[model samples]
Target: MRRPDVALVAWGLLGTVAASLALAVAGQLPFGLVVLDVGIALAIAAPIALRLLGVVIPDVLVTATLLAAAGGVVVAHTALAARLAPRDLPLLHFAAALVIALVFMPGQAWLRAATNRLVLRRSRHQQAALQAFLHTLSPELGTLECCRRALAELVRVRQVPGAAIILRDGEAIAHGDFDLAPLVHVWPRGAAADALPARSFGTIELRALPLALREALVRAHVTLGAGPILSPRRRWGHLFLNTGMLGGFFHEDDVEGFQAFVAQLALLLDGADLLARTVAVERSLAHAEKLAALGELAARIAHEIRNPVTAARSLAQQLSREPGLPWVAEHRLILEELERVERRVGELLRFARRDELRFEPVDLGELARATLDALRPRLDAAGIAAGLEASPGVVARADRDKLRQVLVNLLENARDALATSPSPRRVTVAVRNGEGVATLSVTDNGPGAPAEVLSRLFEPFFSTKQTGTGLGLAIARHAVEAHGGAIVAAPAEGAGLAFRVTLPLAETP
Candidate 1:
């Protein structure tokens, strides 16, 4: 609710007195009727003030008060007329009051409407300034300093006594002189009684804004129309303001400007979110690149150091085979460990190489069959069967040896998974040509890779197996990527591991 403007009050009072005098003369009443007419005009003005101020001053109370006051004026005029024998004394008194009513209706309505419009225009100007302020909050320019600056500018431009931005996380932070947390936490959640059709009214306790501030607002004629700040994920706070004194209530335009201002702020917030995510992604990439370089260096060092160790161990094993060696078993054990180290070194070197591939048009079906045949001894030892279903002539341009290595890795993983699992232990290699692309999948009946490892499965030297170099899938990924293809691990429906590899077929010359 707002206080009435002094100018409007004065204008209504002045007009009421002058118009009441004219009506008195027209009805031929005596000059003494002027004071009576002025009194009646003041009575009418009070009720109109109460209505504009959003008070529930009942119509019956206004009518009863006016009728009782009018009755007294009538009785006095009738007594005076009886003494002087004046014509139409009762009619003249009634006419004066009617004139007051007629004059007050249009005058009061125009004043209220004009004041509301002025307030809306003032609010709109403030909103435009706030929109410009929000643009400065972009993180690309760096820091929350811009947001702080925007906050300050908002306070100054809006002439807001105080302003604050309270994050939904319950951070009670102030911007300029405004302390938002207290206001936000205690702000009304439901509808307002004086709710205008155009804008939502935020709850305002009369004590929160002083009469001086209210008077200044009415004097400045600031109007605000606003809505609650709400988000699907969280409760966003609202954009609202109290207009000091020049008050009639807000019109449609003020609400529109407020809603638009908040919408722009939301966009700025979204941009900040995107900028933060981009920074995170770049940091992740940098970290991944660093780790890849370190892995390559470690792999190279292993290859460089293993050859000499392997040669020395082979010599030791050969010498130990002679009858004179008392610790032959220990020497043999050393040789076996050295052999394992050599194998690991070879795996590392394979992972480290990033040389240009020697591309050739090769049949994926034939390549997969050959890989399976080579791993037949291991399959037999594990007591696992193999199923090969391939699309004929599914050719792609890639390094045949590298593709075969990828298939071998896939087969080895499938065989290992089968050995560890109960029930059926079988691996499937299926190749298909559809949707203008070729695909090959190796599936097995074993537990699927853990969700935690799935994202990092292609990373070098990350493995779950005790005796694994952890570079098998990583090398396989590198090989497929080199040929403009993709390989992915998925759970097999029936039982074990399933690896899907997709490749683009070569275009005909």
Candidate 2:
């Protein structure tokens, strides 16, 4: 199979041809010439024929035997045809060898091809299977099923007894022999790695990979193999085959064949990963587009609503100032209510419009006290006790109005939460000054937010309150981030919720 030992075949052919020609030339031999001719033909074809029958003989010996028989046939036939004398033998022998090589080499080649098909029947079968699965395997339902089918295809292609597909997410399926579990991501630590033999095929160390990969290889029983599942960017997974399934370990040709199949699987996984990311990006872009549209609509509505709101507030103020008005107190209440509506409308506009930050250094300690005073009436009405713990000279560089708005929203949320809190319905505003940062933590005695709702708290249109527009925390988060700060909400110790706002400390003046 390496290369035909042409010299050996020529010698064998020469000996057979010479022996037969000698008997023919002697002319006194019996009717044995015809019998020897048939024997010579079988002998010429036997070495190649033996290989086709799956008989393993030394390559050199088989080549020599086959070539010699072909040479014998040529010499015998030439001698019979020419019937030359012994002294003229040198030229005739040379002519016989050349004629055999030229005339029969083509036939030999065709015969060799025919025998090769027989010798490599399994390889041909594998090619057929790979071609079949090329169009059959698809990534649908899930990766697990698709990969499992791929494993089955490999089993067919390799003619292996069994195989397995172990997914990254912990699902495992087999070609027949493995009973995969619901999950097998966690590899056994320590001695449990010994279940599989310590051997490698390509770059895949079955034992060193994951547990699922190791288990699948050991079950197959072949270690000296090629099972590398590779990609240009990452390791998707691997493939393995049984060495003793139908025969022994995979031949050199088998190794070359599997490379293509494994590559296709790796490409599939890479494409799937890319597709998922693209879908996620598409969803995010659509969500952002919707948000942008809503922002424009909200901006227009706020501008239109502000006109009537301002006029109503001014009209109420003018009427309250009139002398001897019968409903002076009622008019005063209407003016106060109008002012509250105007303030609410202002918050709506601030939230809807993306205004650039008007950054200035502000004393957060003083601001916290002022915010509590402004909301003093609401606190009194709710029967909530308020307190402030401020570090001296706690200051931050931020947009004053926007930063105050974030604090007010946090405080208002806390106040509303504490409305039903027992006994000491308390709200604490604490400001801490540290190296290059200021942290404002607002805590209240109220039922804390659930763990499930904490993550989406800052997502626009997500809310817990019945009448809430759900923009408060979202707007607060936006404002804080605009000033290069961060806001986090979490359950407070024991009872209630806490909002921590951290901002960059202002340069000391």
Candidate 3:
């Protein structure tokens, strides 16, 4: 028997002996009747009283104590009765033996089995409920959806007003009436592994917690039962319950259920994260394949159009050179239009063909300044104010000519965007060096493209401008990517568009 059970038996025996002695001293009732009353009361009422006091005593211990008390009572009664009437001793002995054999032994076993079934029935129901909840969590559900469903089920099972799931990165999903912001701030990264118990389920009483967390919980109007969602690799987040109204307590079965739920939730979160990444990679691969096929087709078509376009331009130029030709002005216009077509074909070919890069240490600040200087005449003509912001020694390993062309394209793109803007139309080019990379950006104070347009900005033949051939940005992207760099366009702060280029910094000797 456990220590508590042994103590309880000892105390119970002492109390029974004392009660019998008091009844004998009073001389109001027979000792046999007194013992019988005491034994029956203890057998029937002890379990009920202990349960009312929230003490969980095993039914086997109760049965054993009752049997020991009854045997003592029978022995004491038989000794006293034999002195009074020796003739009836055999009858008394036989009756006592018959009762012990036919009733007490078999009754104890049946009583133990019956009590156990009654006690464990609730626990079995709880386990079944938990299992059904787990089954509802399908693999296809996303992280937020999982959290929402889990919180809903927790509130239902635990009968709490609120619940929350706060991930390690500070993303939170909350359900019910409670405020979770304070809780989130206090347990943003969840409990540390070393701080948590082995089972990872713990109660958080307002008084027992640290002052700051306690105050935060008080402000949020909740006491907490929290479990870490952890795996062998890492802790994903925490699951929290509002247990203040529950007197900051959880049943043993509830704790076990909580631990199981969080363990499975961690695995589900991992699977969801992996699935999202897999989908993104698949999309990226598909887009790359599509772009490659489009580039190949564009190259073939450009090759077929280039020779005929060159011949037409040459013939138009020859016709314009004849001094006596009628409609000379019209002939000049034809030559100009053909030349424009030739330029577009050349841009298409550049965008389609991948050229071998000649990489060298190129000062990005200097390159920006030179590109701006070359475009100064056009900027003056367009009434657009252009300025450059550069940090010293911000250099990158790149093909100088190709990199120069990229800057020229971006600046011209910005200049064109600013053409219709109101007074003080401006373009700013900035260069700065960061960890292992150099960044250059050209920003314009002009109407920026919407998100839908921005997404297709670098695609060949995708343009918003009426007169655009749409190959400039596409070619710029190819050249920048060849040098192990990236280019992106976004709406600049306040107004207009910003195009940023990032390149790997040149290594220093």
Candidate 4:
């Protein structure tokens, strides 16, 4: 558009015309004049018509006219006086014109191609930078605010105008200038039409924008492309971008760069996800340490407190017996309540104590049955039928008392769960020997633990039960761990909660 540039292009074209005219006149006057006149006239006419009559006239028309004029001049000059003709001059001129045209053709093509390659190379560099940034960012920045700022910086560096990122949990933490109503409103149509795939990130064509919105977008010159931010489990969510006239309307380079951006972004997202998991794991370990400390302290305190509780209960009983007191029954109830308090305190002390186990060879099958027998009265009271599937003489290396306590706690929890369900409550305790270990499962026909609770089931003081101190499972976990085994909760395939306890089998002497 600059005057000097325009003048240079015009001078080159005019020089070609002048050379053709001179060749015609010097060799054969009439024929040369006709060819020159026609070409020159058309060359001058085309641009004026283009300005006034618009682009309907093809560029090919001008090129063709010039070629014809040059050819005509050559032929006329060749036919004239042979000696004066410089016989090969006309052919040389024509060949030269053709060679010039061919050279310029390739030059223009090379320039165009080079421009495209430059864009692609720059895009790749930008993408690489993004990947590097994300890899470092995930660990250092975990909050949404950090993610948002990082995202904004990425878009800014890429020279994109507007973009939005949606996390897997349906939270759209966004950055840049974008009205999401268009995207939200259009997503159903896009989804119904399979515009976005179920679990992968993808791109939407700018031309694919809804009619009215697309028109408005075009006016704003906003173009968009999207791809998924994938993690191992699933895609986080669709990343929507409005590249607001920069980066030039979704070219091949832009698409490639966007895809590379997503790939790197996904890596960061995965790191963020892993970092989150790590933080959670660390938190859990801290809580467990605290609980273990508390449990140990409680056990020691319980040992100390039991002696006094026993003395107080004995004194209360003697006082009750001695009464011609008006409220003898009430006094007896108080003594009973004192006894119950002692029992609970005993359980807590047991949970906290680090008692060395008396490991001995024992039949797990018989132990399982005895545990069920002790809880039979409670199961009957709760109207829950108890079933046992035992592999007899399955020997285990464990403290018999402690292992039996584990089973009893499991059964009691099952009975409590069954009490809340409708009629026909059922609980099953299954024992089997597999591979190198003995497995015991206590399953009940009741609603399973809620998903949220499942995450913290072994955590101390975390219970959903109204009267639960949240220590039962915590205690059971400790006992199993003490025996060099594991206790885990899983929803039963049948009707209720299933507690699986595993212990290594005793090696034959």
Say which candidate scores most in lDDT.
3
The weakest ten consecutive residues by lDDT in model 1 span: 190-199
* Residue clash pairs of candidate 2: 9-67, 9-68, 12-68, 13-68, 13-71, 13-72, 17-72
**Whole-model lDDT per candidate:** 0.64, 0.68, 0.76, 0.68
Cα lDDT tens digits for candidate 3, 1-509: 22333456567767776777777778845874678577756744553354333323334455665678578758876776868677887777777777776546776766544543444222345556755786778757877887788788776765566778777777888888667778777764544523544454343333444677666656565544467788766777777766432224345655676788788777877777788889889998998888788888888888899899888888888887887899987987888888888788788778777889999999999999988999999998899988999999998999999999999899889888988888788899999998779999999999999999999999878888999988899999989999999999999999999999999999899
Q: Candidates ranked by TM-score, best first?
A: 3, 2, 4, 1
Candidate 3 weakest ten by summed lDDT: 115-124
Per-prediction TM-score, please? Answer: 0.49, 0.50, 0.70, 0.50
Better of 1 and 3 by TM-score: 3
Native-to-model Cα distance after best TM-score fit, residue 440 in candidate 4, in Å: 3.2
Distance from true location, Cα of 189 in model 3, Å: 6.5
As a whole number from 0 to 100, the lDDT of residue 66 in candidate 2 is: 62
lDDT of 1: 0.64
lDDT of 1 by residue, 132-250 (tens): 77765666653244434555675677554434444444333345433343354443333431131233443243234445534433332233423434433333444445444332344
> What local lDDT does model 1 show for residue 183?
50
lDDT tens digits, residue span 1-509, model 4 = 22322454476558657867787768866766666666666655543443332222223434454567556655654554354556766666676567557645764455444543443223446767776666556454764654586578666767655677655555666666665655544343323333444332223454554566454444332345456665555566667665532133345555666777766666676676788899899998997799889888888877888888899898887787773766887877888888777877877887777788899987888888887888888788878899899987678899999888888888888877877799889988888999799998998879888778787888777778887867778888898998889988988886577889999888888
Q: Give the TM-score of candidate 1.
A: 0.49
Model 4 accuracy (lDDT, Cα): 0.68
Off by over 4 Å in 2: 1-124, 127-229, 237-259, 318-336, 357-464, 476-509
Question: What is the alpha-carbon lDDT for the whole of candidate 2?
Answer: 0.68
